[model samples]
Target: MVVRDAKPDEQTVTSLAAAAGTAPSMFNAQPWRFRYLRDAATFQLRAALDRTLPHTDPHGRALHLGCGAALFNLRVAAAHAGWEPVVTLLPDPYDPRLLATVRLAPADAPDQELARLHPTLTRRHSSRVPFRDELVPEPVRARLRAAAEREGGQLHFPSIWHVRAILELVRDAEGRDRATPARAEERERWTRTPEEARTATDGVVEQVLGPYGGYHSIPVRDLAGRHSAFEQGDPTPFEEEPQLALLGTAEDRPADWLRAGQAMERVLLLCTEYGLSTGLTTQVLEWSELRWPVRDPESGMGQVQMVIRLGYGPPVPGSPRRPVGQILEID
Candidate 1:
């Protein structure tokens, strides 16, 4: 119920789109596009189907999650820029690719909560390295859970047995990928070569791949697989009881995935603010057979969206992002 003024300037649109593009994606595919409707003062979010992983994400659920994360970043950027974002998810059913339309309206009072997170936006990066054994404190865990709840999602800390089971499933997934090389096509496509890693605008690179978990069994996804010649430096054992959390929604629909993505980013930002390093493991969740068992049997919250690992660890370099001009279109 908010009215828009004249079209937003090109600079403002570009800045917002650029900030939105910083959100993380599976394998750094960044499969999302933005279009600024000058006349309507709205920014449209659409899935970049060409950048999607057909083998791993056939139904485009992961793609939607990535786009939703970008949408959240857009909202935060708009608030930081002193504008209120009025969002409409799946705005047009006839156009399924159109994920959202955000109208930038003048705000009587800007959202301070969202604006405060701007500083942490660029600081948050996925750490593939080993995390210390130290546990995340109760107070910080409470805050993370609250952050997820605010975004219409639930974050659950799995039991020891559940963690072991999840790790086993992840190992199974890795073994399957090794055996079925065809399934790795999408992964290989998104992982850059050494030379390309240095200059490429998108995709995960060798430097961020971290040391291989030779003896230790941390649930970190091995982006390097068997192709990279990069040596594993200072192989140290990861934490024995690594802290893990499960992000889930009440429902398993596209809209719910969007909410889960927003929640995931919120929790991640909060964790970053608390000096916690984070990593994600979605290999088990990628397959339906292994995904069901990931949920906490007691909680009855079965729709798992992401598995988060958090601890104190070394800083990870931020991945490159596509230029704002490449992602944003003005109409």
Candidate 2:
């Protein structure tokens, strides 16, 4: 068996880090850090606790999900660059914040499946605008389900009744947020002002918030709280049946959350490659009491990691990312 060299070049590391940095996170918080071990040829993903959304993501499950997505991107980037990535989730139990370690080694054959997704990494952004009522073709839906399954998770398109329950739970969570000043304050920390949005490297910007969903029926999360500058658009009814999917796993541990995150990104990238716009709502799942009913009662899906909306719609602008240098530490 052949082993790869212990060190990768600076340019290679920088490129991979940049690609990994593109993965989506809660409220665009981008709560992750990468450290490349030159001697070991491994890239470590660590949680940036300072960036955590304490009130919204109290248990850090969302943060783990975001980091897991970043880890998958690193794998794709390495594959595209003609290397094989061997990833280990939660590599250090002693340090819970260390989410993953990916060893990039020279490969006899690059991972074509992963390399194929590299191009779509930057193209996939959360679209908060309304999606057309058109149905996502059955074949396309099958492909997305396969994408999640490939990463060891299940993606279920909930039945209409389940969808209604999920939506109502979201409404309840939103109502709770309205009553909880701390939750709103936590959200504001990651939401950029118009001026900040123009230059900030992180957080959800005002422009990308889309016009206020004039109707509460829309599934899009209102990032622009009461203080937003954008005026509400005309009150239009959202589609009676929006294309929604719940990404889940058999368990709800940190390792499971990490796997769920990778699955979520794989599904998102596949959707983007097929020209689908996506939005996410984890509001319901954020609350333990509301999370259980979101699951399909018959499917045996234990935990729902994310609530995703997919359809044909105008693309939303990409959020800013911290510089690669700032996110990557060489050791």
Candidate 3:
């Protein structure tokens, strides 16, 4: 591969990082770092351990998926910036921590399709609010499923019974984790107070937490109410039934997690592109007991990595991101 010094405009760099910022994470915890090599027109992704949500993501599978989503964003940005992103996932297996090293290769040109997704990068957020009861047509879901498949994953739209089953798993997992002293301590450390300046890196804050309500179908682990120190939004009953889909992979491995993350982002981006809102729940997948059993009996997938809820609703308030300076290092 060709390697040489390259320079992009200020707007390009800012926009590129902005795209990466849109990547979804466990509880909106964007725990990933980006290193751009200006000379080589490449972006290197690494898992930022300090930002990790250990209480929720113990094995780093979710961590890798979050980084993978950011990596996918960088690729889309590269393509939109008129270059082909030649990615080497886990380029140095001996240095297993290196999530990906992406080199941008010259391409014919970028088209509208590539440039189109750039806006959605920042617009995409995990919407937890109840969706309008309106159903997402089969054709729209088919398009989304195809989008996931393009990135080596499949999206399974769950039926009513399946949705209820997965919902119970989420509730069980949340209750089990929340009851722990160690997990509660971690939650306190990351959750912020209103007096504090909005942090670029941390857990879900008041603004990002959508309309508050008792845990219902997509059981939200009560982050604020449990603390007893904070007040929550007015209770809105879980009246709307959301369109739920299972984001699954055929294999269960570190590399597969990375691919699943990319697929998750692609699906989310497509949703944004289609003017649909989405909320992501991995509580069931995070708990080992619920993961394998939650997989659709017919899909024959090895694991369910993420449960995505999508429909029409208010957009989730954008969460803060660590400044590029804080997340990057120069070699």
My TM-score estimates for the predictions, one after another, are 0.95, 0.95, 0.90
Question: Model 2: per-residue lDDT, tens digit, 267-327?
Answer: 9999999999998888888889988888888777888999999999987888898999889
Ranking by lDDT: 2, 1, 3
**Pairs with backbone N, CA or C atoms under 3 Å apart (clashes), candidate 2:** none
Highest lDDT: which candidate? 2
The residue-level lDDT of candidate 3 at 51 comes to 74
Error of 2 at 247 (Å): 0.2
Q: What is candidate 1's TM-score against the reference?
A: 0.95
Q: What C-alpha RMSD separates each model from the true structure?
A: 2.4, 2.1, 3.1
Backbone clashes (count) for model 3: 0
lDDT of 1 by residue, 140-163 (tens): 999999999988999998888888
What candidate 1 gets wrong by more than 4 Å, as runs, is 1-7, 227-235
Better structure of 1 and 3 per lDDT = 1
lDDT of 2 at 270: 92
TM-score of 2: 0.95
lDDT of 3 at 190: 62
Q: List the residue pairs that clash in candidate 3.
A: none
Global CA lDDT of candidate 3, please? 0.76
